[model samples]
Target: MADKMLQGKVAVVGAGAKNLGGLISRTLGADGASIVVHYHSASTKTPADETVRAVEASGGKAFAMQGDLTKVEHVVKLFDETIKRYGRLDIAVNTVGKVLKKPFIETTEKDYDEMFAINAKAAYFFIQEAGKRMNEGGKIITILTSLLAAFTGLYSTYAGSKASVEHFTRAAAKEFGPRGISVTSVAPGPMDTPFFYPAESPEAVAYHKSQSMNGKLTDISDIVPIVKFLATDGWWITGQTIFANGGYTTR
Candidate 1:
């Protein structure tokens, strides 16, 4: 891809205030895409501002919007606001997820509902709204966990909820292919972020590192290029969940 492959495009990054989401937002913005950096709450507003400033400093355009995407209305508003701000949507990336490491029997009703709400329901609606609002030949990407490919204990709800998005991506790919839209998911192995460490024990972290080819957890840097690729030059690869966990897990 060229240096500014995403130049003149517009992207909506869910949970774009910090961490992997923040990195993706900044990367896309730096690549010349006008970014709609969607943060989940007021606590992250400052980071959202920083992300926007970072993009602008890099010679790109961006603005931050706050919303709870678990509610379908908020998901709709995100895209609507993106179009309102940027006039069009060319790419949508959702990195919103929650992790839990409890046995199935120990999980509560509230836990299951919350997991599915953000991981599955929010994902489905995000894609739906994006499809409805995006310009032709747009890209839709979701960040998932490598546990989707693992026969692991615990994480029953975390993995199970994210598991639904693989199928959602597949179906969305076909349904939206006629419009030149590409929908795909990226599943990384025990990523090196706050999102990963809290749910893991010290021993579990060691085990995750052992499984990867480089004996390290996946980094946000490791995945940003993949998302950028799918959003630009790699647009042809649709409906597939790219397992980007080094050798951690594969199907």
Candidate 2:
């Protein structure tokens, strides 16, 4: 691949300050893209700030923007900040998500609503607002989950949230195809992040590991390259969910 495959591009990675989001931001920055690192909270500096540091360290340009993605106004503000700082918006990777774990019966309306607000509704508007500012050949990628297909117990709301994102990718791709913007989702299973620590329980941990073909956990680093690929190289592909789950799905 060319060293500058993403040169001169501007990207916004929401929730970019910690864990997988931070890693994805750094990887894209390393590939020569200028970045807008978006975080949700104000109390603490987000992982996106650290991402900016890493990007500058690697000789790329980046700055930090903060907003609540759950609200349309804030989502719009995120992009506005990006454009104000960078002059253009080219790629928006929606990596903001939360999982509310409980059995379907125990799940509350509030849980469903909150998950949808952050995981689904946020991405939809993020793309909408960013799309308005994005130039030709722009890209939008969202982090999805194999759980939507696996539909395991204890994640009814979570799975529904991700399933919404998967379908949104398809719809957005079609809606934006004429303008040359690509929309896609990358779904992974059993990733090694702070999000997966319930696996510390011996029985549940064993079961989770067993689901992988290799009986191992997928590292955050393992997923960054694929996220980078979908954001840049796989331009012709859109509306599809590429599962990066260590062979967690064979069908």
Candidate 3:
């Protein structure tokens, strides 16, 4: 069997300034991969720098990059800088997303466009650029929401936008397979992040916790190992959305 260790590999983590993305970057860096930590906004720069510092402190090489991934040029620049700095790309993980809990009736065109731009369009270009830049045996993972599997309402734009990533994962897996690249998505349940709290009510948060095991929301810790696996030994499992939501929702 091929060794799955990440030592000496190069990884680009999109939205890697904090939360799940931050953890993934640090985890992989600890395992010996050089990291390109990409943050989306100026406010995220500190966290991005912190993540890079953690990586370097772990004895791995790292640096921070900033870009609005909704723009293809920015996406291109992201990968371009990764290759320019690292000399090779081995893993790409995208955690860029925006959530909206408005009713479909109340959702404006702007809301829908912005949701798709961040969740769908950005994801597509990320995969496209990664495929172009990555060497053989590379891995690409995207963060999606388990809401994609739920039979519910009130998240029409949120869920609907993320749903598009499944197909992108499938197609990328097929196209990139011959080159020894693996593509996949990880869908976490209602995570206990600021990102989730803003869009959810207290009642909805409680309900989400009840549906998962241990009566708690998914933590960033819960999802990172699964992503790390996909980037390493779990390479054989591609073209699928793996739900790591503690049984919050399943197909």
The root-mean-square deviation over C-alpha atoms between each candidate and the true structure, in angstroms, is 1.8, 2.3, 0.8
Evaluated with TM-score, which candidate comes out highest?
Answer: 3
Query: lDDT of all the models against the reference?
Result: 0.92, 0.82, 0.94
**Model 3 worst lDDT run, 10 consecutive residues:** 1-10
Clashing pairs in 2: 16-48, 17-47, 17-48, 18-47
lDDT score, candidate 2:
0.82
Best by lDDT: 3
Is 1 or 3 the stronger prediction by lDDT? 3
**lDDT score, candidate 1, position 141:** 99
Candidate 2 stretches with Cα past 4 Å from truth are: 1-4, 43-46, 198-200
In model 1, which runs have C-alpha deviations exceeding 4 angstroms? 1-4
Q: Write the per-residue lDDT of candidate 2 for residues 1-251, one digit (tens) a residue.
A: 21226888888998887788888788888888888788777743746667789999999998887888898998888888888888998888888988776878877889889999989899889878877888878888998887766846787777788788888888889988888888889888878888777524667777777888889877888788887877777788888888888877644
**TM-score between candidate 3 and the true structure:** 0.98
After superposing candidate 3, which stretches have Cα over 4 Å from the reference? Answer: 1-3
Taking all chains together, each candidate's TM-score versus the true structure is: 0.97, 0.93, 0.98
Please give, for residues 68-123, the per-residue lDDT of candidate 3 as tens digits.
99999999999999888889999999999999998879999999999999999999
